[model samples]
Every structure is written in C-alpha cells, then in structure tokens.
Target chain A: MSASRHRLGRLIGNAVLLAAVATTLAPLLWMLVTSLRPKQDVFDGALPSALTFDNFSAVLHSVDIGRQLLNSVIFAGGVTLGQLAIGIPAAYAFSQSRGRWSRWAFAVLLLTMSVPFVVVYLPNYILLSEVGLLDSHAGMILPQVASAYGIFLLRQHFQAFPRAIVEAARIDGASEWMVLWRVVVPASRSAISALAIFVFISTWNEYVWPQLVAGAPGMQTLSVGVAAFASEEAGTQWGSIMAAATIACLPTVAAFLALRRQIFNVLLEGAVKG
Target chain B: MAPALLLFGAFVLWPIARTGWLSLHDWNLVSPDREFVGLDNYSELLGDPDFHRLLGRTLMYVAIGLVGGFLLPVGLAMLTLRHAGRATGVYQTLLFVPTVITTAVGALVWQFMYLPSGGPVNELLDTVGISPVNWLKDPSTALPAVGVVGAWQNLGFSYMIALAGLSAVSPTLLEAAELDGASGWQLLRHVVLPLLMPTLLFLATTAVLHALPNVFVAIEILTSGGPAGSSSNLLYDVYSNGLRFFRVGEASAEAVVLMALIGGAAVWQMRLIERGVTYER
Candidate 1:
C-alpha cells in the first residue's frame, strides 16, 4: 500500500509540473499556431485545415520587417559591444581595488540598479534632444550602454578569478590590461556569454525606452514595430499580427533553445550567488 | 577608473541631477524659459484625486503580484526540488520561456487568451459549466488579470531563486526529519521553509520592485487604465501626464513620489539582505 501510494504521489507530482510548464509555454505555442493559420481561419473554432506560409511572407515582404530586424540586430549588437567596452574595465577596477573609492563606487552601482528609469526618463530625453540625437540609433544605444547589472555581474565574475593567476601573469611581465585580457576574460567566458545573451535579449525585447527615444517609424526596433502594428488597427489582421510577433520573438526563442543549458546555469548561478 | 567615472558622471549622475532640477520647474518641450514652481507641482499633486487612485491601484498591483508571482514560483520550486535531474532541465527551460518574451508581445498574447469568446481561458471555464468572465474589460478583474500575466512571466526567475535556496539546505537535516516521521508537507514546512527564508525575502523584495515598473506595461496593453480608470497606476499616470498631456511639472511630481516609494522599498530590501546574512546560522 505504501509503495502504491508513493507511486501515486510521484505520478501526481509529474502531472502537476507538466501542467505548470504547459501553462507557462502555451501562449508561445499558440503564437506559432496563430502565425501559421490562414488569415481567414485565424479566429475560427478549429485549427486551419491547411497551414500557409503567406503570413510569414507578408510580414517579411510587405512590411519593413527586414529593415526592422536589421535595425534590431545593429542596435542590440552596438549596445552589447558598447557595454563590454566600458563595463569590463570598470568591473576590473572594482574587482582589483581595496580602497574606499572602489568600495563606495560599487555601492553606488548597486544603488543605480534600484533607481527607476522613469525618474530620469525626461532628463534623458531632453539631453538626447539637446545633442540632436532624437530619433537616432545613437540616442537609444548611448543611454543603455552602461548597465548597472552588467557591471555588477562582471565584477562578481572578476572577483571569482584566481589571484594567483593574476600574480603569475604580472610576474611574467604582463601588464594589467594583458592580465585582464589573457587570464580573466578567458576564465570568465561563461559568465560573460550569459551576460551578453541577457543584454542582447533585453535590448531586442525592450519596448519603452526604444519607443520613447526612437520615435520615427524608420528607426523603430522589433518591439516598437509590433506595438505600432497592433495599435494601427487597420482592421483586425490577427494572423498578420501573430506572424509579426512570432517573427519578432524568434531570435530570443532560438537563442534560448540553442543555449538552454548555459542560460539555465547562468540564471541558477545568479540566484545562488544572490 | 577615471574614464569609467567620467562616463558614469556624464551618463548616469548628470541625467539624475537634471531630473531633479526639472522636477522643481514647469518646463514644456517647446518652451525656452523654465517657470519656477517651488513645490506647487507636488502640492497640486496632493490635491489630485486621480493621483491618489493611481497610488492605491499601484499598491493593489504590488500586493496581488507579490502573492501570485512569488508564491506560485516558490511552490513550483519546492515541488521540483526533490526531482532535480534531467527532467528538471526541461521543466526549467519551459518555465523560463515566458520571461524571455517582450512585455508588449506577452501582453498582446495574454490579451487574446483572456478574450471572452474563443479564448482558451473561457473555453476551459465553459467546460466546467461556469459562465465566461470578461477579464480585461471588467474593472474588478482587470488589475488582477494583468497581475496574473506579470506573475506568469516572472515565475521562472523566482522559482530558480527558491530552488537555489532549497539546494543550500543540509541533506543531513532533511534525513533527520524523515527519520523523525515527518510527512512530505511537514518536511517541507519544517525543514525547507525556514532554511529558505533569506532567499524568499530577497526574491519577494525584488519581485515587488520589478512589479512597479511593469504596471505601466500592464496599463498600456491590458486595460489602458480602463473600465473607469480603475487600473490607472502611478507609472501610467505619470506617462499620461508628461508624455501625452505634456504636463511636465505634474508628471515630474508624480515621478518623484514613485521614486520615494520605490526607494523606500529598496532600502528595506538592503536591510533584509543584511539581516539575512546575520540570521543564516
């Protein structure tokens, strides 16, 4: 009886977890289904009798989705590059220092994470406008280049680097920059890749900041483009909207699937460290 | 160090300082001169019923989000903790899928799901012989409905945090509990929950702060602060005032109030972190 009860409990547990996972992922699956359904059959009771690739073609061909996708890639790429360029050295300095200034600076960095962007949104807009960068890629990229989370995560990774390796590199006549490049960066690839994936995904999916800064249609990212597409209300083109959304979501989903293990490890590691 | 500091000053600190200055004056986008308000904006905000309603609504959003967001994830983490193996990876990946979707996109998806007709949520209800409910349209269900979506997106991250916490518990203690004839729920309540409090507090605090900014997205996509402004949160109110109506001063005042509320929560979170370290023994 006890064995049977244990088996029953295990079955129930697996069922519940599977249900939760399905509930969580159902919308995304529905998005793919809706995207493929013919436009006329989008809201029909049952699935479309025959799936069509026309919606994908329409989104890719009819709209400026190709340009928007390119714009998203460039914008996300530029910000990721910019963040690594600035964030690494700052993280290195914070990791290496044992002084009051570095300690205080790290604290300030933590404080920035908690500071809401809304507080400074207006000022940022005004500043970007003052510099004549409104409706430009530079306007969107400049503000996001310095992420507090990036600095914090990198500092955590850097602090975990072995001091003996740095000393060995220094004794071999390696400069600080050389040590960082050869020893630290190579050792921390997993963390850096995790952070890069995060930054890329976030920048790709970010809506409000891009919406606020990149106002013109030509400069819009995928998220903003989808929002604009939906808000236009040029009749209820449910299939087309789903197609565009699916296309917009494909990169992140593909990235997650490709790097599922690493992404999971990074998130779990972050949670553990926190 | 110098270059980093210079960039931070130029990018982060200077913008924050400018926001402070802008808050004290009435400046429009087209105006060349700044009109000195001298706390009139804040005082006027105090008299605005809409601001009060938004604050109350924001608190409700936070409360509902905290329960659904943190509790559901914690429960999932606890359930999955004993089964940590290859299958766990699949569960975690599927769960984290929602967090990666754009908030705008997720909102649109949920908006369809909550549709009264032909929506899966209502279809399930109909199978149970219950009447279909208008989720986003009704004032009563609007905020909670949005909160559910927010919770769904956030569940994976919080679950991961709780699982991390659960993993830190000493296996010997769990064995001891089992030997003491502890049932499954008792093992969890007595052995697991206490050890997990620090991580729980951390997750809860972060969850609350994250929920605040999200209210704006919820307002935008789900209800548009609709069904008689029941869902007009502080963030949406600020956006509507400053961006839509160009009431720079009023919006600045609202922003300042929100910062205070969120800043207070941040301070509380820091204190919790410090206390967690001390209490871990």
Candidate 2:
C-alpha cells in the first residue's frame, strides 16, 4: 500500500511540474508566434498559420533598431570589459593588501554592496550631465563599471585561491605582473567570465539607467529602443512591438544558452552567499 | 587600489553624498540658480499622500510577491530534488530561460499577453469555462498581475538557491530520519526545513529589495505606474520625478529617503540572519 501511495505522489508531482514548465514558457512561445504573424492575425492563438518577417523588417528599417543595437553592445560591452579590467585588478590588490588603510577602505566599500544604484542614479546623472556625458555611451558605461559587489565577490574567490601557487610562481622568476597574468588569471577564468556574463546580461536588460542618461533614440540600449517602440506602438502596432521585444531579447537569450555553465555558476553563487 | 578607490569615491560614495546635498536645494537640474532649501523636499514628501501610497504599494508588492515567490520556488526546489535524472536538466533550463530574458522584454511580453481583448490569456480563460479578466487594467488586479510577472522572472533564481540549500544538507540526516520511520513530509518538515532557514532569510530580504528597485523595468514598460498610479513604487517615483520631470531636488530627496530605508532594512536582515547562522553549526 505504501509503495502504491509513493508512486501516486511521484506521478502527481511530475504532472504538476510539467504543467508549470508549459505555463512559464507560454508567453515566450506566444511572443515568437505573434512576432511572425501579420498585424491582423497576431491575436489568433499560439501558432501563426502564416509566418512573415515584415514586423522584424519594419522595426529594423523604420524603427532604427540597428543603431540601437550598436549602442547596446557598446554600452553593455563597454561596461563588461571595463568592470572586468578594473574589478580584477582591484580585487587582486584588495586580496593581497596587507595594510591597515586598505582594510579600512575595504570595510567602507562593503557597505555599498547592497545599496542599489537607483539611490545614487539621480546624483550620478547630474554629475554625468555636468561632464557632458549625458546622451552618450560613456555616461551609460562609466557609472556602472565600478561595482563594489564585484570586488567583494572576487575577493572571496581570491581568498580561496591557494597562496602557495603564487609563491611558487615568484620562485620561478616570474614578476608580479607575469604571475598575475600567467598564473592567477588562468586559474580564476571561470569567476572572471561569470562576472562578465552578469554585467553584460544585466546591462543589456538595463532600462532606467539608460532611460535617464541616454534617452536620445540614437544612443539608448536595445531595452530603451524596444520600450520606445512599445509605448508608441502598443495600441495599434502590436505585431511590431512583439517583433521589437524579440529582437531585444534574442542576444541575451543566445548568450545565456551558449554560456550556460558560467551564468549558472554566477547566479548560483549569488543565491548561496548573497 | 588607486583605480578602484578613485572610481568608488567618484561614483558610489560621492554620488551618495552629493545626493544628500542636492536634497537640500531647489535646483531644476538645468538652471544655474541654486537656492538652498533646508529639509523642505523631505518634509514635502512626508506630507504627500501620493508618496505615502507609493511606499505602501511598494511594500504591498513585496509582501504579495513573497506570498507566491517563496511557496512556488520552494515547491519547485523540492520537486526538482525528488529526481536526479537527465530530464531534470531540461526542466531546469526551461524554468531558468526566463531569467535571461531582458526585464523590459519580459514586461513587454506579459503586457501583450494581458490585453483584455484578443489576448491569448483571455482565450485560455474562455476555454477554461471562466470569463476573461482584465489583468492589468483593473486597479485591484493590476498590482498583483505585475507582481506575478516579477515572481515568474525571479522563480529560477530562488529555485537555484533552494536546490543549493537542499543539496548542502547532510544525506545522513535524511537516512537517519528514514531509518526512524519518518515519512517524506516529516523529513522535510523536521529535518530539511530547519536547515533551510538561512536560504529563506536571504530569499526574503532579496525579494523585498528586488520588488522595490529591480522591478521598475516591468512597471515602467507595462503600466507606466498607471490605472491611477496603482503600481508605482518608490524607485519608479524617483525615476519619474527626477529623470522625467527634471525635478532634481525632489527626486534626490526621495533617493536619500530610499537609501536610509534600505540601509535600515539591511542592518535588520544581518541581525536576523546572523543570530540564526552563527549558532547553526
């Protein structure tokens, strides 16, 4: 009797889970279908009987999606590259610093880890505008690159890094820079790429920051581009908005699928420790 | 060290201090005229009913999000943990793919889906022998609908956390419980749940923070905090006020208020979690 009961429970569990998976994916499936159908047929269920790329072409040609795509890459890629460049060095120095001042500074920096950037966005906007970076990609990337959490996370990972390895590299006649590049970097590539994936994905999805700073159509990220399309086209141009959203989501989705392991590692680490 | 210190001082620390200073002034962000107003913006905010409603709604969204957010992910975690087969990988990917979608895109997708007429959701409802509901149009239903999207977007992150918590749990404890004739329910209740407290606390705190600031993309895109501003949160207000209206002083004041609230909550979380976590071993 117990064995039968357990089997029933397992069966019920599987059915419920599969249903949830379908529910969660239904919207995306609908979006893809809607993006393909012509304007008249968008509301007609999950699959399009007829498929066309006219909506995609309209967004690209009339809506200026190509310009926005370039801006998004520049902004998100710039931030990703900049954060890695600065964050890795800062993290290394922070991990190796054996001094009182650095420790005090590190403690002070930790306070900002959970402080959401939204709080400082206004002032930062003002500063960026003052520096003539408003409506520019520099404005978009510069403010985001200095991440306290990045340093904090990397510091933890670096702490776990074996020190004997570094000492052995030093004994092998490698300079500090060479040791960092040839030895430490190769070892911590996973953590570094994980950080890159996060910064890039989040930046790609970033709406408010780019909205505030790069509101100009030529300079905004894909998110702002799609949002502009939605706000204007939501009522009458449903198919186009669907197409634009698909365009905005495609890259991040591709990245996530391609770099699945790295993204999962970062997200999993954040869930556990953060 | 110099680069990090310079960047942090220029951006994070200084922006905070400047925001504090800007809160005390009457600057319209463009004009050269800067008049000092002591505590006026904050005082105005305190008396403003709309600001109060914004705060209340933000708290409500977080509260409502927690209701489904905690239960759903925890349930998913347990369900996923029950089996260790290859199908688990496919299920995990399907559930997690939403997390990769841009929040703006996610919001747009849901906004489209929630259309009152000719929307797929309405069609599904009609087929299920229930009349269609205006998910985002009605004020009473709007916030919860928006909250559902947030919960969906975050479900994967939360599920991953719970799975980690489950796996980290000692297998010997489970075996011992089973050996003592403890059923599945009892094993989860007595053995697994207690060990999962830290994960819950972390989840709770993040759920609140995510609702406040991180949810703006959805709210901005979907409703624009509309249907009589039913879905506007504090951060959305900050964005709409300062950035949209160029009301620098008022927006900066709101930012400061939000920062203080977040700081206080973080301290509370540390205390709450540290007490339990310190003695766990």
Candidate 3:
C-alpha cells in the first residue's frame, strides 16, 4: 500500500510539473505562431492554414525597425560596458577596503537599491535636459551605469576570491589594476558572465526609462518601438505587433539561451543569499 | 576608491538628493526659477481622492500579484524540483522566455489573447460551454487580467529562485524522512518549507516590489488607468500628474507617498529576512 501510494504521489508530481510547464510556455508559443501567421489569419486561429513571412517583412519595412534595433543594441551595449567599467573598480575597492566608511557605503548602496526608478526619473530627465544630453544615448546609458546590484554581485564574487593570490601578485610588484584584471577577473569568469547576462537582459527589456528618456523616433529603443506599435489607435494588428515583439525579444532570448548556465548560477546565488 | 566614490557621489547620490530638493519646489521643464512650496505638495496630495484611490489600487495589485505571481511561481518551482533530469534545463529555458519579453510586448500579446471575439482564450471557453468575457474592457476584470500577465511574466524568475533554494536542501534529510515513513505532504510541510523560508521571504519581498512598479505599465497599456481611472496606481498617478497634467508639485507629493510606502515595506522585509535566514557553518 505504501509503495502504491508513493507511486501515486510521483505520478501526481510529474503531472503538476508538466501542467506548470505548459502554462508557462503556452503564451510564448502563441507569440511565435502569431508572429509567423499571415495578418488576416491571426484572428482565424486555424494554424494560419498557410504560414508566411509577410508579417515579419511588414514589421521591418513599415516600421523604422532597423534604426530602432540599432539604437537598442547601442544603448544596451553602452550601459553594459559602462556599468562594468565603473562597477568593477568600485566593487574591488569595497572588497579590499577595511574601514567603517566602506561598510557604511555598502549599506548606503543597499538602501539606494530600494529607491524605485520613478523617484529618479523626473530629476534625471531634468538633469539630462539641462546638460543637453536628453534624448541621447549618453543620457540613456549614463544614469544607469552605477548599478548597486552589479556592484553587490561583483563584490560578493570578489570577496570569495583567494586573498593569497592577490598577496602573491602584490609581492611580485603588480599594481592593483593589473591584479584586478589578471588575477581577480580571470578567476571570477562565471560571476562576470552572469552579471553580463543579467545586465544585457535588463537593459534590453527595460521600458519605462527608455520610453521617458528616448522619446524621439530616431532615439527610441526596441521596447518603446514595439510599444508604439501596440499602443497605436488603429485596429489591433495582432500579427504585425507579435512579429515586432518577436524581433524585439530575439537578442535577449539568444543571450539568455547562450549563457543559460551562468544566468542560472547567478539567479541561484541571489535566491539563496539575496 | 576615490574614483569610485567620486563617480557614485556625482551620479547616484547627487541625483537622488537633487530629486528630494526638486520635490520641495514648484518646478517645470523650462522654468528658470522654482517657487518655494513647503509641504504644500504633501498637503495637496493628502486632500486628493484620486491619489488615495491609486494607492489603494497599488496595494491591491501588490496583494494579488504576491499570491498569484509570487507564491504560484514558488509552487511551480517546487514541482519542477521533483523532476531533476536532463530535460529540466529545457523546461527552465522555455518557462523563462516570457520574462525576457518586454512588458509592452507581453501586454499586447495577452490583449490579443483575451479579445472577446476570435481570441483563443474565448474560443477555448466556448468549447467548454462558457460565454466570452471582456477581460480588459471591464474595470473589475482589468486589474486582475493585467495581474495575471504580470504573474505569467514573473513565474520563471520566481521558480528559478525557489528551485535554487530547494537544491540546497540536504538529500540526507529527505532520506531520513523517508526512513521515518513520512508521507510526501508531510515531508514537504515539515521539512522542505521551513528550510526554504529564507528564499521564500526574499522572493516575496522582491515580488511585491516588482509588482508595485509593474502596475504602472499595465495601466499604461491596457486601461491607461481608466474606465474612470479604476486601474490607476500610485506610479501612474505620478506620471499623469507630472507628465500629463504638468502638475509637478502634485506629482512630487504622489511620489513621496510611493517612496514612503515602498521604503517602509523594504525595511519590514529586511527585518524579516534577517530573522529568517539561517547560516549553515
């Protein structure tokens, strides 16, 4: 009886998991199907009867999707690079410093993470406008460069680094920068990869900041571009919108799939320790 | 250290301080000088019924999302944990795809799905002998519909976190439970959940925060905070007041309220998290 009950429990568990998987993946599958379907057949929903690339073509041609895609790529790339450039050194300093001030600074960084984007959006807009950087890539990327989460993650990884290695490198007369690059970075490949994936995905999918900062058509990122298509007053053109969305989602999805292990590791660590 | 501190001070801290200062004045986009308004914004916000409604809506959104988006995802993660095999990675990837999609895109896709006529959701309902329901058009259903989308988008992230927490559970403990003839439900309740409390707390807090900001997106896309501003949340109120109506002072006051609420919640969560986390030496 106990054995049978165990088998029953296992069966139920598998069934529930499969159901969860289906529920989670169904909308994405629908998105792909809708994107590939001909425009008129989107509402018809009989597997399109004849799948076509027309929606993707229309989305690309009718919209300034190419320019928008480029803008998004540049913005995302710039933010990722800027954050790494600034965050790495800061994280290193925080890790190496042995003072109450550093500890207090770290706490302040943690506190700042709770400040929502809305709180900063208005002031940043005004500041950027005053500096003639509004609606520019610099404006888009600069404010987001100093990420508390990135600094925190990198600091955690740096703390886990072998102090002996850094000591030996210093004994060899290596500079701090050289030790950071040659010793710490080389050892923390997983953490760096994880942070990169996280940052890329976030910057790619970010909406509100991009919407507010990059209002000009030429400066708009992919998220805002797709949002424009969706929010238009014309009749809902499901196929084209889905196609645009699919295109917008491609880069991040590709990145996530490519760095799946690293992403999972970072998420796992964050979940356990966050 | 100097370089890092200088950059942070110039960029992050200064901007935050500037926002606080800006909130105290009646400022505009093009204005050279700002009028001094000492707590006038706060008083005006306290008197506004719309702002109160939006705060209530935001609270409701957080509540619904915490249960559906946050807890449901944890449950799904636990379910996924039972199947630790080669295909688990595939499942994880597929499930997390929605999270990478932009909120605008997810809202649009779901809007199409929830269309009263010719949408798959309604068609499925018809097959089960139920009449179609207008999901987004109705005020009562709009917030919940958007909440569902939010849940769908966040399900993967929450699941991954919970799964990671579950992985840290010692197999020896499970084996011991089995030897003691503890049933599946008993093992889950008595052993697994207590051990997973820290992860759960973290997930819950972050989920609430995520949900609060997201109400604005949902309002913007689906309802624009309307059918008479029924779906308006604190963020949307801030946006509407500041951007739409050009009422910077009122918007600043609304924002102050939002900041206070979120800050309070964060503090409460930090305390809970500090108490809950158990370090294994």
lDDT of 3 by residue, A184-260 (tens): 99888878878887887788888888888887889989889888877672447888888888888787888778878
| Chain B TM-score list for all models | 0.86, 0.87, 0.84
Put down candidate 2 lDDT per residue, A19-91, tens digits, no spaces.
Answer: 8889888888888888889878877776777999999998887787778888988988999998888888788
lDDT of 2 by residue, B149-214 (tens): 877787777666666666566755754554456386787687767876776776677666666665
Model 3 alpha-carbon drift over 4 Å, by segment: B31-33, B83-86, B171-193, B272-281
lDDT tens string, model 1, A116-158? Answer: 7766677677788899998998888988886677788788789
Candidate lDDT (C-alpha), each: 0.77, 0.80, 0.77
Give the fraction of reference interface contacts each candidate recovers. Answer: 0.52, 0.66, 0.57
How well does candidate 1 score on lDDT at residue A16?
87
**Residues forming the 10-long window of minimal summed lDDT in candidate 2 chain B:** B272-281
Per-prediction interface RMSD in Å: 2.5, 2.4, 2.3
Hey, what RMSD does candidate 2 come out at? 2.8
